[model samples]
Target: MVHKFAFENPHLKAEAVSAVVMTDLAQQYKVMSTPHLVLNGTRAVKGRLSEETLLAAILVEAG
Candidate 1:
């Protein structure tokens, strides 16, 4: 999920928000240790999965 400190504290300066934004974006796009699947905006799953896992991910994302 994109967890920006500015979301909680709107007064945060652009520099601080940028720091968090860049970090989150990097993690989402990074090659190493990346999650196998992202469910919803927060949930993550790694490694091989079954139909149940797929269903859960779809449901979470749909919500």
Candidate 2:
């Protein structure tokens, strides 16, 4: 099963989307596979990532 989660902080925020239902969005963002994480619409890292790796990716785009 798929699930979506969300959270926010003074400095950062995040939400989850199910690509299966949001096909158009998934395509628009070039999310061709599962476990894809897009940060700030400026960059995306495909596949599952470790906490550190995800943070790094987000930082790159948050800049």
RMSD of each: 11.1, 4.0
| Model 1 C-alpha lDDT versus the unseen true structure | 0.47
For model 1 the local lDDT of residue 21 reads 48
Task: Judge candidate 2 against the unseen true structure and give its global Cα lDDT, from 0 to 1.
Answer: 0.68
TM-score, predicted candidate 2 vs. hidden true structure: 0.73
Candidate 2 lDDT tens digits, 1-63? 112122433566566789999999988998878788777775777876777777666667767
- lDDT, candidate 1, at 58: 52
Residues 21-62, candidate 1: write the lDDT tens digits: 467754664424433444443665666667666556655655
Q: Least accurate stretch of 10 residues (summed lDDT) in model 1?
A: 11-20
Q: Name the lDDT value of residue 3 in candidate 2.
A: 23
Residue 62's lDDT in candidate 2: 62
